[model samples]
Every structure is written in C-alpha cells, then in structure tokens.
Target: MPPAVRERISAVTQKGVTLKDVAAAAQVSRATAARALNSYGYVGGETARRVLEAADRLGYRGNRIAEALRRGQLPLVGFVPGDIQNPFFARIAHDLEVELRKQRHNLLIASSEEDVEQEKELLDSLRSLSIRGFIVAPASATDNRHIAELAVGNVPLVLVDRAVKDVQCDSVVVDNEGGAREAVDYLVANGHRRIALLRDDSRIFTAQERLAGYQNSLREHGIALDESLVSISRSTVEHAVEATIRQFSRRDRPTALFTVDSLMTQGALLALRSMGLSIPHDVSLVGFDDFNLATFTDPQITVVAQPISEIGPLAAKLLLDRLAGNRPAIRNIRFPTRLVVRGSVLHPRKS
Candidate 1:
C-alpha cells in the first residue's frame, strides 16, 4: 500500500486529521487541498503531489458520502434487474458492482421479480434514496412509463439487456436477433426442418427480438412459418415444461427445439427427459444464454453466448461518462453474440 493508504490504516484510533490540517501542512488553501484530493479541478502536478504527501503524513481520510452531500450529489448508483433468480442477471449485477466499486461508488441492487408494477415501485424507492444514476433491465417493454419519466427528469440512466420501445436512453444490449437467427440456422443446416421455438412472453424485449429472429431465419430458409410450432408466454420452468410436452405430444412433432432463454432451455431438457426422448436422436436442442449448468448436462447444450463479461463494464462506463458531464447524444450499443456448439445439436433422424 501507498503511504497515504498505509497511514490511514495505521491511524485506526487517531481522529483529528482533517482537510484543514492537510492544507496547513502542505502550505496551501483548503480549496486547493480539496481539489487536489478529489481530482475535480485543475491543480499543478507539484502542488497535488505536495498535498498528497501532507495527507499521507497527517493520515487525513475523507468521507465520500459526506463530501458528495456537500457537493449536492449522491455517491450511490442503482442497479435494477427484472429477476435476480436468473443467473444471467445475477452475473451482470455482480460484475456491475465490481466496476462501480473501482470508481469509489457504492452499488444498490434491487430486483423487480419480472413484475412491471414492482419495477416501478422499486425505481421509486431507489430514487427516494437519492441514487446518482440507474442501470436497468426492464421487465416489460410496453409498460416503461416509469423509465420514461426518469429520462424526462434528466436522470442519468442506462438500459441493460432489454430496451423499451419509446423510452430512449443509453443502452448496452446483446444481439438477441442475430444470436437467435444463428441458432436456428445451425439447426436448419443439421437437416431439421420442423424446429419448435420456446420463448417467454412478447412483453419482454429480448424475447420479442429472439422470436423475430427465429421466424426470419425460418422464412429465409424457405420454411413456411408454422404458428403451432412456436410456444410463447412460457415464463417459468413449469410453464415451459408443460408447453414443451404439449408440443412434442402432437402427431406432427418438431424435429428440433430452440429455446430463447436459459429457464426455458432447462425446462425443455427436463420435458424431453420425462418423455424418454434422446438428444439429437429424437430431438436436437439449441438454447440462448450459455450457463454453467448447460455444460454439465448429459450432452452439453449448444447455446448462443452473450458477452456477459463486457456488458456490465460497458454499462458502468456509460453511466460514469454521463456522471462526468459528457452529455453526448444517447447511444445504443448492441454487442454481438456467439454460438458455442457442443454435443447437443445433430442431424435429424429419418422417420
């Protein structure tokens, strides 16, 4: 550790060191010392070094929350996710917290549990706590009135994973459409014509985009769109399992299944297992959003992997830029997805 941080740690019981003392020791005004400490305003290099040395010798430690309040700002950043149960969102949240901590800011996380009203209430509660900005994955694309209000109020906000239709703001999202298309295209190349899609409700933006990509790929490959092969509004594992079972029980069952999200993918696997259907023997499978459990399955699942590691850091950088007074036009950054082919997908068996 540097001398300043080391001295701070050593001075556990000493409490008299202050900015005034540091300024006096450095032979500079309190304003100059403050600027040097915070790196807010322009200060001469030598002057900053001297002030830092004085602070280190005196063991002067600043209270970040108190300083932020004095400057009419909050040192807290808010992160609101639609559901924390999803490992994808949890990973994003964890990465975001790590990035925020590096910038000397505290992260406050709240879950909406995939409820629109609950999301609004959580936003309201976080706003009341004087959050500096927000990073959100919207629960419903159509019902984003609260998010719109945040933009209107000039609060720095960044959308992650999901983007609302009318609520324009900075966003960092994966290429859901392209990923879905790639997965479906891979299935088609494996000689699977009858491909079934299992997805969440269209209220969520990611689900909608993935569904569009699935449909578009089928159309591009000269496969007539079959509405009966698509399963929508399957939000939970139980719902997805039921939908998958119902679809497979049909006289004209699909040869392959493409799930739009992790939960639905797990459910589809369970449903296939319960029906005694073998992977790529009875039905090939492709899923969106790679997770740890995907690799541990009997035959590792093939999935469209989003850049989870980059998403959170990119979102944090956007918010931090806005906080630093960079008011450029809103930007929508869509990261590309990759298809990791494992042992799951294979050529369809002849009838």
Candidate 2:
C-alpha cells in the first residue's frame, strides 16, 4: 500500500477497533471481548490476553465507557476533614496539596463542619467521584458503620488525627496520650498539686485520649482525680472561656489547668484575666499544640507541641502510597510531641 493509503488504513482501524471489532478480529463474541477487557470473572486468561493483543495491534483506543466499567475513571485521592477553618486542618490541607502535586495526581477536598450528616454527605459525594483513596479526619459524631462502609468498598483509606473504633485502616496521628501525660507531668513537677483539666468535646478521640492521659498521670502521682475540676467544652474558644471562669470563682479553684487544644487555651486565658487570677500566682495553664498567639498572651503559654507542618506531608504520602498499590496491611503512624515550657506554669504559691 502507498504510505498515505497505509496511514489512512491505520487510522480507520484505530477508529473501528471497538469491542465489536476486537471481538471479530479475535474470533470471539462481543460480550466475551467486553468481559475480558473489564476483568470480569470467568474470562479465561488466554482468551483475555489474545483479545487485548488483537486490540492493541489494531491501534485501538478504548472508549470512556469501557474504561469506567473496566478500571473506573481517571484517578483521584480525597481528603475529608472536620472544621476546615481550624488552623490545624488548614495546614494539613496545604501539605496534602503540595505532596499530591509532586505526584501529578488530583485532590478532592471536603469538610464536614463537625456534623455527622455532613460527614456522611461528603463521603457519598467523594464515592460518586470514584476516588480510590482517602485521608479522613472523622467528625466527632461519626459512627463505626460510616467507617465500615468505606472498608467494605475496598477503598484505600487513611485516618488522620481521629480514627474510628474497631475499623482497621492506615492512620497518621500524634501521640495524644503521651503528650498529655508530659504536659501534666510538667505541671506536677512544678508543684501543681491541684490541677484542673479543660477538656474539648468528649466525643472527639483526641479529647478523650488526652483526658485519659491526664487522669492517668494524676493517679500515678497519687493525686485524686477531681471530677469537679474537669470541664468539657464543645471545642469552641468562647465556651471554654466561660466554663473556666465558672470553675475559677469557686472557693476551691484549681491551681493549674491542662487545656485540650489551642482554641481552648484562648478561653482559659480570658477566664484567668476576668477572675483577676495571675499565671502561676493563682492558676497556671498548659496547652496542647502551640498556637500563633501563645507567645502574645500576658504570660506566654507553655504548650505540648506536635510537628504540625510535617503531619500534612506524612498523611499525603500515606495516601499516595496506597494509590500506588503497595496495599500493605493498614499502617498506624504516630508522631512524637514535645513539651515547650514558657512562663505560664509554675510552683503552687502559699495561700
């Protein structure tokens, strides 16, 4: 054939070599060719290979429908987090974006605003997008069934910060229990015998874990756990501040407090000021996860610090690894935390 004629023939073959053409070329039925292409059960390996080779030789480009039915659409990895406005979650999103950019894969980001129904809705949307992998920070109210459904779908999922109970999956988390213990230990060592706990919502995994750590350390030091001194907030800075003042007005106020989060730290500071309490004089406070404003407080806040910038990259890398088919059994990665002592904590003063 002339060069131009040969080119035309090739072009025509490319255009015509759909499942119908592959079936005819391989001396098989169209349904069999489709089954082979889609990796469906009962298609003999030898037959599948022959059909594939024939399709390749014909210069065929598979249709979108065939690709979707066979292997799903273009690849995507998702990140679903609660409270996107929180600085912690924002940092996570930024790092995940950078990491995914390095791999040339797309990201789908969603927020649940700490609502259970919103979380479920976001998950449903991501599933519809055919995302094969996910990095999720479940809402405080998320249920086990919500997590189990993802597992059942065989999605490569990684939990960040908070994890679902009894659901096995890859996770990137901080040493919440250990960090809290360190914070409390520091306070006790400084002679804070009457320590209070300013807790975030009990429904949150981190909050509950940190509370356990606080209680454990108190018990270890022979300090009786005072339920009256433990205040639970809805994870809002305002609510925490109000609760702190209420606790402080009592005749028997705690000499020191271990706050659950940066936002809660703000509330504690406000309460201290409102009640004319001076840091380390009347009450001392320790915070979890250093915040930008920690240094600006009247007495700079002491904090248990996690490597926030590193957390994002680590979680993104785990999701990328799953997308690459490593599929090693679920991994649990815990990062270490450090205690940053500042002017906020001190020895208990004589009454």
Candidate 3:
C-alpha cells in the first residue's frame, strides 16, 4: 500500500473506528454490540466483554444521545420550607444542601411563606421539574388534602420539623412533647407554682405537640391547669409578646412563663422587658428552641434545644434512601431534645 494510504488506514483504525468495524470484530450482531455499548439491553456476560473490548481496541466513539437515554435522568432533591427566612428552616436547608452535595445531587429550595395555597403551588412546581426526592417542612395551616395527594402519588419524600399525621412518610423530628414538658418541669421545680404557658397556635404539628407536653406536665405536677394563664399566639414574635403581656396583666399573674419556639422566646423576652419586669426576680422565664441571641439576652434565656443539625442531615439521608429503591414502608424518626438551664429560669422570689 502507498505510504499515504497506509497512514489513512491507520488513522481510521486507531482514531476513527466506527460501530460497523466493532460489530464485525466482535463477531456478534450489530444490534448486540449496540446494546452492550449503549447500556440499553442485556447481553451475556462473555458477549458483553467481547463487545466492550472490540469497541475499546477500535477506539469506537459512543453515541452521546444513546448514553443520555440510557442514563435516564439527573439526580435532584427538592426542599420546601414554610419560610426560608426563619432561622430554623434556614439552618435545616443549609445542612440538607451540604449533605446532598456529597451525593452529587442538586437541591431545589422553595418557600411557601406559611400559606397553604402557596405550599401546594410550590409542591406542584417542584413535581413538574421531576424532582427525585423531597425534604419538606409543611405550612402550619396546610390542608391535609393537598399533602395527601403528594403522599398518594408515591413521591419519595421526607418530612422535617412539622408533619401531618395522616400523611405517611419518613420524618425526622424533635421530641417536642418531652422538651416542652421538661421546660415546664424545670420551672415548676424552681418553685414556680403560678406558671403560664404561652405557645404557638396549634395549627402546626410541632406546636400542638409542645402544647400537649406543657399541659401534661402542669397537670401531672398537681398544678391546676388554668386556661386564663395559657395563651396561643401566632408564629410571629409580636403576637407572642402581646399574648405574654395579656396573660401577665391579669390580677393573678403567673410567676414563670413557658413559651415555645425561638421566635416566641424573643417575643416573651421583649414583652417582659417592655413591662419593666426583671427576669428571674420579677418573673422567671423558660423557652423552647435556643438561638444565637438566647445566651446574650438580659439574663440568658434557658431553653429546650432541638437538634436542628441532626434533623436536617437525617431527613436528607432518609429521602435519599427512598430514592435508592429501599422501601421500608414509612418512618417517623423522632430525635431527643435537650433542656439548657440558664439564668433566665430561676427560683421564684418570696412575695
């Protein structure tokens, strides 16, 4: 052969081997080689090796389209929160994103602004994007019907923080009842007989659980459950503060107030300060869920601390597990809570 012709043959053989040549060399049907190369159909173990080797030696270029079709879909995880601005939800999202990144999966975050309609709309939007899995903190007042649809659709989902009872799915949550009970128990032990319970509205699962815990503790300790001293406020700090003042302004005011959630804690503190009531001395205080400013308050607020970091990572792992084809029914994994006793909760002063 001429030198130029020889070089052209070498180039075709080495750098530009086609599928026809690979199929011929493999001594199998073109269909078989195509399947083995594109990862479409199953080939016998020995046949698969022969096809792969022939393609490798011939430098056969793969069909990118076929490869994409075989690979199926991109890995995606959705995270929907009641409000991304809320510190608790923000922390959860941060942890979830970090863990999901390690798995080479992308995260899609959305906020519902605590509106039921908004939550349903966002969920639909995420579904439209073909999200592989979900980590959701549902809105407090969300209608169960909307969430039920998501559950019945068999979307791999993990509920974090708050969850609806009928919606069966994997969940990671704090021990709300125990934490609230412990907060009130600590106050009662500190000689606070006239204690008040100010908590978030029961529209949320967590709020309801915490309230039940508070009520149980007070009733269990032989303290007459006074409805007048108990108030349920919205999630806003201002509403909590207003509720606190209203409870405190009564003729027989509570000596210690137990509020749930970090925002509510701030509200309670602000209410006390505005009323010129000193912490521990004038009125003892205990709140649930500690935050950055908890320790820096006038007299550091004692709190029942939820494991925010743990919940986020665990919820992510659960959602990923569901995505991985491990269907062990559904789980409700509840994490333990810790009571951090600080200066804010103290022994009531002698009248």
User: Which numbered prediction scores highest in lDDT against the true structure?
Assistant: 1
Candidate 3 residue lDDT tens string, 73-117: 768788998778778988999999999989888788998877778
Q: Model 2 reaches what TM-score against the true structure? A: 0.77
**Winner by lDDT between candidate 2 and candidate 1:** 1
What local lDDT does model 2 show for residue 312?
84
lDDT of 1 by residue, 126-179 (tens): 887678899999999898889999988888999999988888799999899999
Each prediction's whole-model lDDT (CA): 0.89, 0.82, 0.82
Give the count of colliding residue pairs in each prediction. Answer: 0, 0, 0
Candidate 2 per-residue lDDT, tens place, 41-149, comes to 6788788887887677776677764376236566677888888777788888888888888987667788887777888888988787677788888876246577778
- Deviation from native of the Cα of residue 61 in model 1, angstroms: 17
Error of 2 at 294 (Å): 1.2
How many clashes in candidate 3? 0
- Model 1 quality (TM-score): 0.79
lDDT for model 2 comes to 0.82
